[model samples]
Target chain A: MKSALSTLLQQTADLRQAIRHKSHTGVTSGLVQGAMQGNVVILPADWANEFLLFCQKNPVSCPLIGVSEVGRYDMPELGHDIDMRHDIPEYYVYRDGVKVESRSDIEDIWQDDMVAFVLGCSFSFENALSQAGLTPRNVEEAVNVSMFETNIETVPAGRFFGNTVVTMRPYTPKDAIRAIQITTRFPKAHGAPLHFGSPQDIGISDLSKPDYGDAVTINDKEVPVFWACGVTPQVAIRNAKPPICITHAPGKMLVTDILDTALAVL
Target chain B: MKSALSTLLQQTADLRQAIRHKSHTGVTSGLVQGAMQGNVVILPADWANEFLLFCQKNPVSCPLIGVSEVGRYDMPELGHDIDMRHDIPEYYVYRDGVKVESRSDIEDIWQDDMVAFVLGCSFSFENALSQAGLTPRNVEEAVNVSMFETNIETVPAGRFFGNTVVTMRPYTPKDAIRAIQITTRFPKAHGAPLHFGSPQDIGISDLSKPDYGDAVTINDKEVPVFWACGVTPQVAIRNAKPPICITHAPGKMLVTDILDTALAVL
Candidate 1:
């Protein structure tokens, strides 16, 4: 009889295998249960150092979990048998800052000097929130979390610079307080929230119209709690205009074997 | 040469001596810096058990740090040579649920059946917040923290039952997040805030007119963050209509030798 932990691990590995074979090429949100799913960023070696500095300076927005050596496709620290080129369910190919194409795999365009960076995503904490009975609205609604661009600027590093991007989830004050405590444990997954209450305070004028992803209902008694989104790095990369860059498509991520609870800090 | 820790200890002892001698009879807010200051409650032996159960059931509003034996005036666990009858700067004496008189000391009225309770107060965490550069508005203005009676009910114990009382501090969303994290470390000091943002959500009608203590300014960009107040037990005692009840006057706390940092959980 397999334990629950072993069952989760088997399911995670199976999902990754399915993604690798291009048999599962859809949004990875709420998939693989307790396993970590990360945002993918692939840049040429010439641009990798600057991007690393960006992540270091703006840790809440871009929490770098695993960085592949130049031209390497595996991230052994994040998971066993993880292949950067094909593990993600879907990939976005960007040319000179503008997204040019979406593909099931990036193996054909994978460069020798390409470096893959895996950033810790909010999915880890979202799973924790659900287990704690505070399910994120996006997960409950089966939609992408609402992502918005804010006036809050990121600390610039070389050519990588842009305003922050945040994901919003509506929760009542009581539930929001508990959510803050629960998420504060996962610093690798953006940790706590950057702001709550008035959306306009952070330059988000309209919660109904998000810059990316579908907007969920913000009830009369609920206030929107905003966390620094993994999409923030993608916005910075777009501004930097690296001649060629690769990223996971919105809501699509690289599933890893690491347990989400393993990211919690004291 | 005395170490910094020794100096603080000496200062705390000296301040307590001043308070005990009636040389200082003002609010203890922001006084004795890093030392723990507590909400004082004195009740007869017949009612002490009920109140103790109340504190146990409603730990946030009445966090029990030290409770003196029946008919005892000394609280050695809280501070060296501490006299509960005179250590607090001021005292409020309630007769059959109604506040009858306020005095600098309660030595004349001390009874053989009396027990003293010292509850954890927000001043401990407020000192920590100030040290972290998030000085509470009440401390900055040298005013008592605003406290309100909320609709949130405490878990009942015997005859002691009433709605919770909460203290308010205003901060912008960003600062409130940091405040929540900082205060969560001090569970004895009411832990994290009970509510933030909308005042009506917690049954607070007017920010300008607090039920107890002086109201502090709430800035334009700020939202009021509230913590379960130490005054809650007083309200419960009032409703219970005990033959006699004694407590520290609003903002007049019993200064203890316990270091505020010692209460931090993690």
Candidate 2:
């Protein structure tokens, strides 16, 4: 008789295998519900040190969870048999700071000088919020979480610098407080929110037209709560103008064997 | 050489002694800064059990920290040699749920059937907020915290039932988020706020006219934050119409030896 834990492990392994074989190329949000899903950033070794410093300086936006050794694809610390080159469902390839192509697998472009950085994503805490009976509207509506580019600037590190990007989730003031408490436990997944009320306070003008991802409903009684997002580091990478950079497509992620609860601070 | 702990102990004892002797009969808001101060409720033995159940049902508003044995004036668990009959700066005496007199000591009225209830007060968390550099406006202005009776009803128990009463403080949205996180650490001291933003949302009509305590300045950028107040139980007791009841005068709390941080959840 297979226990629930063993079943979950097998399911995670099967999903990763499907991704590796180019058979499951879709957004990883809401998939493998309790596992830690991450934002992928593959940079050449020459630029990896600067990116690492950027993450340390702006931890709320770029919470680094697992960083692979130079030229290695396996993140053993993050998962069992996780291969960075083919594990993410979709990948965005960039050249000289501009996104040039999207691919299901980056095995052909895997460089000897590449270093893979897996960052903690908001999906981990979103799962926690759902478990606490405060499901984010994006998940309830079965759509992508809303993302916005803000005027709030990230601290500069080496050649990396840009304004922060944030993801928005709407909740009534009562539920927002509970969500804040729940998310505060997952520091690796952006911890608590950066702002809650008026979007203009953070320089976001329109809530309806987001810079990325589809907009979810914000009811009359609900206030939009904004969190520092994983997309922030991608914007910084663009500003740095690295010759080559790769990232998981927005909403698409690399699912790990690590349990989401494992990232909680308390 | 007196260590800091011993010094704090001496100061708390000195303050209590002063209050006991009627030398210090003012509000205890900022006095004995880091020590725990509590709201007081004295009820006849017949009604004590119902009030006890009320506190249990509404823990956030009436977080019971210590209760004296019936007919006993001393609360050893709250402080060394603490005398509830005289340690508070001022007492409000009620006859059939109406406040009839104010006195420095209740020795003449103290009955063998009276039971003294000490509830955790917001002063503990307000001190913590000040320490975290988010000074609550009431503390800054050296005034009692503004409190309002909200439409949010408390869970009724026996004859005790009334709408929740909340204390208000003003802060910018950013500071309010930080305040929420800081105050969440002290569950016994009202924990996190009950509501934030518009006054009308929680049934507060005007910010300037508080049901109890003086109103402090709410700057243009600040949003009013509300917490479940210790005064809540007094309102419930009023509704219950106990024949004879006593409480600390508004802002006049019973100073205890326990450190404010002693009640923090994390």
Candidate 3:
């Protein structure tokens, strides 16, 4: 009989292959359950070092799970035969600062000077939360996790600086407390929530219309709990106005073979 | 030179001695800083088993730290040369579920058929919070922590049954998240909070008027964070209406030699 982990790894590998072939170009949330998914950032080598410092300075917002060698597309440490250029289901192209277009593959624009960075995503903890029966509202509603720009400032590094971006999940106080504890275990995946209750306190004027991704239902008796999000780097990158950059489209991630449980600390 | 742990232990011993001699008949909060403080409950042997079951059923609210042998006032596991009859600054006496009077010492009322229980108190985590620079509002305002009777029910065990009581501390959303992480390490100290935000959701009608203890200032941006409290068991004891029962007065806890940090789990 095949071991559960091996079966999971095989499933994840198959999913990645499907994504790479453009046969599965859609939001990757909830796909390949138990596997780790990463937020992609492809930048020129000239800009990579400063971006690395930004990640280190604001680890809660951009927890770097894997970084490819300059000009390399494969992150061996993150997965087997993972091609950064095509593994993500969808890619968002940014020129100067603004997002230009979304594509299934970035192979045409892939550069020899590009450095690929894979960041740990909150989707890892979502699996743990669902197993614990504290399914997030986004998962329950089958929509993109709500992402918003907050007034909270991120530590600046070189040209990388902007207000942090956050993902909001509405949970009742009881379940929110449990969610906090569960997510705290996955520090590399943004750790515990940054805030809960009163979105306006974080300068999120509206929860119904997020800066990125679809807003889910915030039921009565539930307070919006906010986690530092990986998309924060994209905002910083826009502020920096790098000549060119590539990132995974919101809700579409680069799936890896690493087990989500492997990210838990203590 | 004495090690820090030994020095703390010695200081705790001296503090206990002071309380035993009636030289210090006041709340034990912030006294002997790193040592543990416990909620005291003395009941006849007949009712001890039921209370034990009650603690087990609701471990978050009544985390059992030490229990004395029937007919004994000494709890060696809790402290060296401990005398439960007098170590607490003040004790509340009850008969038929009614609080009759308060006493400096229980020596005159100590019965040969009595059993002493020392349940963990939330003060154990206050030191941690303060060290993290997130001093609880009660500590800053120099008042007892605001506590309320919540509608949340605890599992009933025999005669002991009642709603859970919770202690509240107001903090900005950021600090509350950190507080949640810090307190979660000490399961014996009520672990993580039961709720944060609207008090009415948990049956707390007014933040200004707590059912027990003084209400501290809830700053404009701060939300009240609630933790399961040791006082919960006292409420249960009242509902049970045991023939005779005794407990430490609110804020007047039994100082033990155990370090507060020692109770933290990974």
Tell me the number of clashing residue pairs for each predicted model.
0, 0, 0
lDDT of 2 by residue, A1-266 (tens): 99877777888899999999989987788988898889889999999999999999999999999999999999999889999999998899999999999999999999999999989999999889998999999899998899999999999999999999999999888898888899999899999999898899888999999998888999987899999999898899889999999999888888988889999989
CAPRI grade, predicted model 2: medium
Candidate 1 wrong stretches, greater than 4 Å? none
Evaluated on CA atoms against the true complex, candidate 2 attains a DockQ of 0.69
- Candidate 3 TM-score over all chains jointly: 0.98
Give the alpha carbon lDDT tens digit for every residue of B182-244 in model 3: 999999999999999988889999999998888889889988999999989889888999999
Weakest lDDT window of 10 consecutive positions for candidate 1 chain B: B3-12
- Model 1 / residue A147 / CA error / Å: 1.1
Error of 3 at B45 (Å): 0.9
Runs of candidate 3 exceeding 4 Å displacement: none
Best candidate according to DockQ = 3
Fraction of native Cα contacts kept in each candidate?
A: 0.67, 0.47, 0.93
Model 1 local distance difference test score: 0.92
- Best-to-worst order by DockQ is 3, 1, 2
Per-residue CA lDDT of model 2 for B144-243, tens digit only, reads 9899999999999999999999999999887888899999999999999998887898899999999989999999778889999999987887889999
Error of 1 at B160 (Å): 0.9
